[model samples]
Target: MTAVRPWDAFTSAEAEVRAMVADPRWQGLSLHDRAHVLAVRILVTPDGDRWLFGAHARWHLHDPADGRWHPAPPPRGTRARQGRHPSAELPLDVIPDGPDFLAEPGSTQAFIGPDVSERLTEQLRVLLRAAGRKSELEYPLTAFGEIFASDVPSTVAAVWGAIMWCAYAPAFDGNERLITVFGEYLRRPLPGDEWVRWLPTPPLVDLVTLVTERARAGRSRAALRLAAVMADTAQILLSDTRFRPRALALLTMVEPVLREPTLDAGLDDDEAVRRAWLERCPARLCRALMGETDREAHFSHAVYDLVEALQFARDPRQAAATFLADLSDSRGALPARLDHRLRLAYEELDRAGLTGTSAGESTEPDGFPVPGRVLTMPAPVTEVAPPDRASAAAVLGAAYATGLAWGGLTGAKVPERGLAGQAALVRRLIHERDDDHF
Candidate 1:
């Protein structure tokens, strides 16, 4: 490890801390076991660094960016005390991803006050070291690098938000207040940036697993809130090129959930449930099928329309017959695979006695061709589309990560005044860093 200690102005119990928590004997323990050792108290900084206190009041500053500890000055201000100090005993959940909160007073001091157990600091060292190895990110702790120095504040905020959400989701408890806070953050503009990036897949998996557990435990409100946050996150993933592929992956994961009938537990009206199901499934199916639209655009989506129609009709068998007749009219021009699936679908319906006529039967002489797919199928009713089960659950995993990040960084709200506000924050950080240097 590098040994760049802080300037003499910074007071710390670094030597004592190292001797206590970094013992050679401790080195033999696995990271997981070391994490559970209760030995230090922690203080989190507004900018996302951590202050670790070990035995005999020994303390060190941990820069998550470098996975290194430095001598730290004692806590001196309100901001330092207000910053999050997660229990050393609880499982570590937050990632130290950040757009420095230099605008907040005492944000500098926010790096020093804290409470946590001993092995926890050691566990964090292990985590930060692992993170440094695995992630391509090289965040700045004391200076603005080329990428961040030139970027706009909004981009910084958005990227920071995305990283925090994706990284810290495993610790999210699905609280409604936190969900509201996340929703408000989402309302801010999230322009994409090339410089800052992270994989959405791992967090997505982590979140989905958590939500599945919550749902299994019958925590309906928590499950729904978690799902809502994920859906909210999808709005960001869909708009950014960097995140679109992961967004598509999210859609694929949730497709089965969409295919199932909408739950009637929270929903009261059968019509409302069907309408909600129709609204979510079709658009998702279209996005998923975008890669398959080469031969016949209309025929490629025939199955989705059939699914929608079957979902809405009073008698699914009769609905299937009507859809097959529409399919039969265009059968000659259909893609071979689509033609094959359609044939199988027709036979499946025929076997169930759901078809009104054989596949080759002629259409009614005055039959108005069902124009523009199943959306125009003989119904005149219109229903508003709202978030439902599958739509919310689609991005659940990612949402939880981002949500926890937000909760952890509750002290560092992004400025609303655009570049001027961000410029000011950066200036403060620079001023603080330069002023503190020997």
Candidate 2:
């Protein structure tokens, strides 16, 4: 940490910051207690400028004369001044996990200027220490190093964003906004030297756990936004061999949310971000997702999610066919009815112009691809393949492979089952879940 501190200009930089937030006492705090530090705003100014932090909507300036910092008096017009807020008072324990990320947005100062980055850097260090993230120590340092040199604003933003979001999520009400800021920053082009080299650092895997646990508990938006951030971070690292595994781990964590049946994954605008994520996906990540279709992780995903993402593939058709084969080859037996429905759905899409040979482009909206496990199946009218004796299990006890395919094609949506059919399909699915718990 000292290596990156600006020693040339500020003769007593390190001493000043340490005085405000003592190292020994800070180090003794647990994860939850340290997390309350998130409510504090620690900012620094340009090199050679004053250092500061905020609490209770007021500011505290570091006093260089005495090497200690204290809250300043308010303006003359203000009423009796209040002492330090309860948050500033050290509590016995600060629980790390909670229902929301920022249940309490604390601040003592109205304005904590930007230069306190090094101070923020110290806070981040304390966090890692409490979380036992010795492996991630260097990342915050890199962030501070860049901010100190005034080199790359983008890199600084990534580091700050990752750390802050980690501290503020779930119980922190401001988590959504913080996550949004982080995602937007990462979406821009951050070179290899700027961010990815720091990937094995923080946001650590703890964030992944947070999203996985509370996503369904009304934090879906926050969770998905973080997913997008992780996705964007993964995109940045895609080309770097050193960080590629870390990138893959990030994407793997979001797969569950991507499998939401509504395809919204809890957000209305999830599709656009979802598409961008799919386009940047590495083939290896894609294969790993397909592997998750085995019996054990079946309920872990929505059947059509991966299939829908394949539209952006370099070879959409091949990906689709392979994924189809993956499903067939996976653990449970493919219900012939559903398999036939899926093949027909693919056939319909082909007929509608998705020759399964699209070159990484959008498929026709009306192409109508169907998933094996759909809440509602599009009612398409076509000639059914006359079943062979064994294939027609209607009267038989056992069955055999039927090489024969469906008969001559007919056309048109079943007019009788248009909107009402969809509504009925949903009703059935809802009732099944409600009644039998299936």
Candidate 3:
């Protein structure tokens, strides 16, 4: 296979950036900098578009008048090039600083990360509104169950929209679509025999062991994929008294993957946020479902990282201390819809009783006292249990069935079993678990 040149990866976008840079307005500029432009971004503001070229660890704004490579204002509370993720195309603080930019999904230099999907958010809110119209209808679990079980066309569409949202962030919220999908799947009415046939006798213990061993053997990516299966089934694993221990054990295995340098490269590097356990077990587990090298998912990871950071703060006042120090400036550039999303996150967290610090409460060593119970990360165990192939196959079958439902709704082509049959199908798709196109 021929390699894709970075410039060729997004031909039209590159052409547009090139055209902007080559305009006669920049003719008077004298440039001696030999460094190649590694990334290109266009910030859309009410005044019009301002083009930015990133090179040599700094972003230079293109000035039409003088064409000098003048420094753009540094992001809030951070020095130039300091605290950026190792693989980040641009600084995290700068991402939420303007209206959302279009990214050509697969390009490494794509300028924007995924913002909260407005359509999905709107659709989901409508569903919640209907569910809450009656005082007897309890929100979240009861509402989610009703929606998931309904075959009503509009409700189904809402469910799929939420599913796409979750697949994007995998776990954008601790109690949103991620919980709805997996929780509904677990709570769906099924015959005793059907339940027995689908899950193993010991629930997901065998599969959990398989994932743990894979993590220990340094097959982190593969382990990540398997752990996602458990994540999808987490409503059962975490909620059921029978399997909570196994869920905790699975959590123990993938916790390191959360803090893995490669994964953390997509997260906030601010020590205050870092010390607050921004990436929790639920968030990381669902995130592992995303593609390894997918730019779309990587950007979504970046957005989710910010959401997690926002969650870390006890309140808006607390957030202003660090990541939100320049909130006023950042919000000025944020699109109205995107601004609404952040506000919604705050509302949801507040409703869950998850946000806020008590008066005069002493802070933890990290200076940020975690608001809720923190699950202890367990020590690694040495004994190995052979994976039950039967259980793995059953879980794959469940996942395949869900894929088929989605396929039926979208009328999109899905992968078929090849000559190697079920195993081949599993091998083909396990890596691309949350890839919509796949």
Candidate 4:
């Protein structure tokens, strides 16, 4: 197969970066820096529609045998010579300061302006629609469940999660029909149980051994990243009240050291920690179901028990509970309604009795739910929707700020700082207090 050209990769990367920067959550982030750019690449999809534009801080590595440092090959097949190939059409050296000019790939600097954004958005809209349609036709429920159960590399799982989230999230509009179709795909069953039989068991011990070995060898970055991903995945599972007991058990067994605060203290790198945590998750789950005769039956029971608790509880429950309940009953209220199938699956889990622990055993507490009447609750007062685009933008801006803060992205940073400040400025710029229409 012919390698994809550097020019094409450059264009693709640029588009991905632009889309991320355009997002409200990323408005404050510095896209020009290499680290930020690399982070964005990890976050964004690299298919034709998505691209990232930013500089990579390249370093030359010296060979001990040779006195000189050699530059790595230009990402395989990419020729350094300018103007040599027909595909090398991008102006690789032009840097434009304003919104008027588009970025040239291989340039020292460039900004993707409005034209590129418009073009890429149109292209992505088409591609995303096509993907949503294809996913509806191809991906089966069993495949998704297998993904949950399989011992696939944590990186692959993270990519899958990000892809599904981006494809289904409400932040990007104009694809309601596609979202609906994809939702159907998630609900159907896969080809067979044979696929599941091949699932790899949790590699918790192996991961622990790897981390220990790597740390001994002084490759801390790899270990940290893996550990962070594991921790993050564990936190995600732990937050789900339905999965709390099993998650807790799995976490304890995988990283017995985590039970002590100091040993797990440096698990702050989100991705690595999540991976480390997930390495043990399957085994923990299996152990939890040790006495159960039917695995599916066990899962179903755990879900229903949790849902029942949520539905009948007098006080606020965990965020996961509220999220799950909203998923099962008020589909329209969810930001990603495509997740409804997963929610229903969990609800079925509750009915299956898998949630019941050994007699009289108490599970650890999870998070508290957001307080509010459910979306289906009857409105006691007249509902007054925001009147103008400015107001709408302000609301969204505030929500984004709040979400960032809640998710721990903003540390030691005040709400009045950074992009939140910019958003405030934009609100003032478009202020229309007198007339409701923006």
lDDT per residue as tens, model 2, 138-226? 22222333222223332233334343322211111111122223333243422112101111122233343333333445555544544
Better of 2 and 3 by TM-score: 3
How far in Å is the alpha carbon of 346 misplaced in model 3? Answer: 32
Give the alpha carbon lDDT tens digit for every residue of 261-298 in model 3: 24433333333223232234333233232322232433
In candidate 1 the C-alpha lDDT for residue 271 amounts to 43
- Cα RMSD for predicted model 4: 25.2
- Cα lDDT tens digits for candidate 4, 1-438: 999654544344446655544456553543244233443342122221111132221111123232222211112122222112121221221111222122111110001000113333333344434433322112222123444333323332332232222110012111223222233323233211210100122223433443443344454544444344444444444432323444454445345443442353365443454354444434314323321223332223233223222322232122123223212122222222212333343344345432211121111112211222122111122121233333333332222222222222212222211222122222222222222111
Candidate 1, 347: how far from true, in Å?
A: 78
| Candidate 2 vs. true structure, TM-score | 0.19
The reply for model 2, stretches above 4 Å from the true place, is 1-137, 140-179, 183-301, 304-338, 357-438
- Regions of model 4 farther than 4 Å from truth: 1-203, 206-213, 253-438
Candidate 4 positional error at 73, Å? 65
Runs off by more than 4 Å, candidate 1: 1-13, 24-206, 209-421, 425-438
lDDT for each residue of candidate 1 in 1-438, tens digit (9 for 90 to 100): 999864431133234433435465654765454444422335554556566543222234454444444333333231442234434433332111111111111100111111112333233333333322321122111111222332222212223233233221221111212112222224332221211111121222233433343444565444443344444444444543323433443444444443442242455443443343334433323322222222132222223333332333343323333343222222332223232323444555445544332122211123422222222221122121112222211122222222222222222221221111111112122211211211
Cα-based lDDT at residue 220, candidate 4: 53
Q: What local lDDT does model 4 show for residue 75?
A: 25
Cα deviation of 259, candidate 3, in Å:
46
